[model samples]
Target: MGTASSQLDPEVTEKVSRDVNDLISKHRVVIFAKNICPYCHMAKNVFIEMNEAYHWVDLSKRPDGREMQYFLADLTGQSTVPRVFVNGKCIGGGQETQELYKKGILQNLLNQS
Candidate 1:
């Protein structure tokens, strides 16, 4: 699944693409992260400390995770772990997420939703 698949089924591609899109679009606050990433913990903690709820997908547990990572890069212009989204909009990685929280923008988004 990592390379060109001459015999790949179209249905499979469609389903995987839809799965990726759904994972990103279905949540108010989406954090695509790896379980062991420190930045991932930091991002999640920000939400926790603020008493905010967020949806998180640990890509390390998915078979199509790398594909989703690439998909995210194309869709959001960044591919790194902890791709944080607020209200279906890409807010970026750990540093960016924390920074937004510090500047009070993240709180506004949370309230808006």
Candidate 2:
């Protein structure tokens, strides 16, 4: 007797969670966001423009996406859309993301880890 968001398929959730964790763990950079978010688009564009490698989690249809969002909020202490994680460290939202790119710290972070 729970809402869809609270009743996600355990297998699917596990798979998605594993995929996300793997991307973050194996890769140097990761971005989590909804597809329609403008900031998400901007962040992606910046990465593309810089030719940086990154993984993206699109939560537009996944039932447990809200759960993932909550997890990000708890992990990063901010619930902003397009939450970016660099080498398992939360680098914050869109503007901060851009600033890091501008300062070239983002590239350095990727190079280090």
lDDT of 1: 0.80
The top-ranked prediction according to lDDT is: 1
Q: Write down the worst ten-residue block by lDDT for model 2.
A: 2-11
Over the full model, what C-alpha lDDT does candidate 2 score relative to the true structure? Answer: 0.77
- Which TM-score value belongs to model 2? 0.78
RMSD for each of the candidates: 3.5, 4.0
Could you tell me which residue pairs clash in candidate 1? none
Per-residue C-alpha lDDT of model 1 across residues 4-69, encoded as one tens digit per residue: 321345665566668867866787888999999999988999999898888888989988776667
Model 1 quality (TM-score): 0.84
Model 2 residue 28 CA deviation in Å? 1.7
Candidate 2 residue 19 C-alpha distance from true site, Å: 5.8
lDDT of each: 0.80, 0.77
Candidate 1: list runs displaced more than 4 Å: 1-13
Clashes of 2: 0
For all predicted structures, in order, the TM-scores are 0.84, 0.78
